[model samples]
Each structure stands twice: as structure tokens, then as C-alpha cells.
Target: MSHAGLFISFEGIDGSGKSTQARLLADHLRGLGHDVVLTREPGGSPGAEEIRALVLQGDPDRWSARTEILLFTAARRDHLERTIQPALEAGKIVICDRFADSTRMYQGLSRGDLRAMVDDLHRLMIGMEPDLTVLIDMDPTKGLSRALARQTVEERFEDFGEELQQAMRTGFLALADEFAERFVTIDGGRGIDEVAADVQQVVSTRLPS
Candidate 1:
């Protein structure tokens, strides 16, 4: 969170409707006359986008855990430098689809007990956290089914299957508790309109556009 701008991030399981909710919030904020910059992780800047393709498009096991962490850190550093920092400095609202939290869950939790490594890299390279983080919580089984319905070339992470996804759901929930200062949990099991309303309420109450 920066004093000059409102930085919001959305976190959830693969099919927990986080992406959709994040977009709707950005639109709603824009309608309220706020300058909003909607972006996604692993590819917000040009360099990060290049890293995103490399990290996501290949086989699931293409890179070892440590190497993958390095790549993600590189992307995040570029994102912060090229896209996020500038937006915040200009006093615009930045709504990111994901941030370093995804790295904690995906690379650290899923691969092994690499949480410290993730935090260390983030602290060293990209030290800022979102001003507000909306964690859309949902049942892992349901989320996985919804995720599988959509087919994409970037299915490498999804290839890890439901068990890991369940773990991820728990990990994210725990994170909300750990980082409660900037976290809000939304029940994404509900309808889109309801979820959007809840998300809007949370953001408006905190940021007011």
C-alpha cells in the first residue's frame, strides 16, 4: 500500500471467480470517477509479460522449484518497476489480479516449504504489499471443477490437480489471517452479483474510490 494511490489485489483458487470479481471492481471504481489501472501478475510489464509466457506455457515440470521462484521474482520486480510503481506515483488505483501471494501459494506451498524463500525474495526485490487484498474464498472441489471447464494454454499450474488446489485454498485462507491488515475474505460461492456487491462494499468502505 502506498500513500499516493490505492493498490488492491485479488487472491483465490484458480476457479474461485477472483479474476471476474477483480474486473468488476475496477469497472465500478472507474464509474465512480477514479483512475483505475487493472493488471495481472507475472505479466503486468513488458519484461514481466515475457516472463509470464516462459513460465506458464511450458510443461508443468519444465523448471525446478527454485528456478521457477527466481523467474517469478524477476517478473514481479519488473512489474513493480514498470507498471505498479508508476501508477501509484501518479495517484491511480491499481487493481491487480494477483501478486506475490500467488507465488507463496503456487511455488512455495505447492512445491515445498519455501515460504521463507518467497518472502525473502519479495522483501529484497518487491517489498510492497497491496493496500487492500480481496481473498475470494470458495470450496476447493467446486473451484477446481469450474477451473477445469475453461481450457487454456496456460494450464500448467492447473495440471497439478485438485489436491494441490485444496491445499492452496487452505493456504490462502491462512494467509488472510496472517496478513489480516490488508486482507478481506469474500465468499465467492455465491452469485456473481452478490460477490461483486460484497467486494464493492469492502473496497468502498476502505478506499472510497
Candidate 2:
């Protein structure tokens, strides 16, 4: 799992603006002449993208908690193998919209008390962690509202309603504590430019010169 490049992942509840910030960071880095690979979970590589449609577009109860953990892990493994690892090995900066941490929150804690199972599978299958994780902390209510407004087919998670979003916010904050070394919390309620500036500053400190 060791590589010559930096691996960064973004984690937050639905509507936390993590995806937009991820893209903004990629654009900033690339403009600075850094080689960057911008990707997302559940559908980064072709194989993982296929699995994404299965897990993200169905009913809220489409897959049980255990089943979801398996599917997300499968997609993550493919993403790592096909997209993430290659870029990292080539010494490129790999910025992922979401990663195993998303699975930990969405599948591990949201549905049931299966976090241990999620961690076990991750250690066994995806034995790596991001060098830095930017957590775009936002109010669950506001985040959920922003998320629903998108009106995309990937609304299965959002369909679970605000209660789930509240729990996810709490869970993600707790996770930031659990893995504080790599997690940096940022207030995401600000304007896009403000948030992107903070993201760039945090990441610039860690990027290789």
C-alpha cells in the first residue's frame, strides 16, 4: 500500500459539499502544475462504477447493512487497484471524493451497529488510509437540503431522510476524533470560494514540493 504519491480523501455526510471541494482542490493543484488524479468512490474505475449503480440508485432498503459493506468494499478494492494505486505509484497526487471512511459511516454505523465488521473487512481487503482527510463539516439539515436539491438518481442515501443525516454528522465528527492524525475538520457552511481557500491551504501544507 505504500506509494510515492500523496493519497487524500474527503469524508462528510450527504450534502456536506465534500465532492465540490474535492474537485476544487484538484483544479487548484493542477493549475499549480502538480500532477493530480481526481476520482470518487463507489465508481472511480470502470468496474467500481458498475457496482456504484447497484448500491446508489436503488431503494433505501435495497441492500442490508452487511450486504452494503461488502459491495462498497468491493468497489473500493477495484478503485484502488485500477485508479488510485497507479496514480500514487507514478508520484501523482490522488484526490478522492470519498473512500472507505464513507463506507464506515454510511454502512457501518447508519444502518446498524456493524462498525467492527466494516473495519475488519477494510483491514483485510483495503489495507490503506488516506494521508490526509478533509472533513467538510456542515449542519445535517442544511446538508440534506442541499443534497436533495440535486435531484439525482444517487439519492438512495439521501432518501433515508434527515434523521440519518444527523446521525452521520455525529458519526463523522466522532470518526475525525478517532483518526485525528489524518483528519482535518473545516466549517462547510461558508461560500464556495471560502471553503475552497481553506481546503487549498490545508492541502498545500501537506503536498510534496
- Per-model TM-score versus the true fold: 0.97, 0.99
Q: Give the per-residue lDDT of model 1 (tens digit) for 85-155.
A: 99999989999999999999999888889989999999999889999999999998999888878988887
- How far off is residue 90 in model 1, in Å? 0.6
Error of 1 at 9 (Å): 0.4
Put down candidate 2 lDDT per residue, 1-209, tens digits, no spaces.
Answer: 89999999998989999999999999999999999999999889999999999999988999999999999999999999999999999999999999988889988998999999999999999999999999999999999999999999999999999999999999999999999999999999999999999999999899997
Best by the lDDT measure? 2
lDDT of 2 at 196: 96
lDDT of 1 at 78: 93
Output the worst ten-in-a-row residue range by lDDT, candidate 2: 101-110
**TM accuracy, model 2:** 0.99
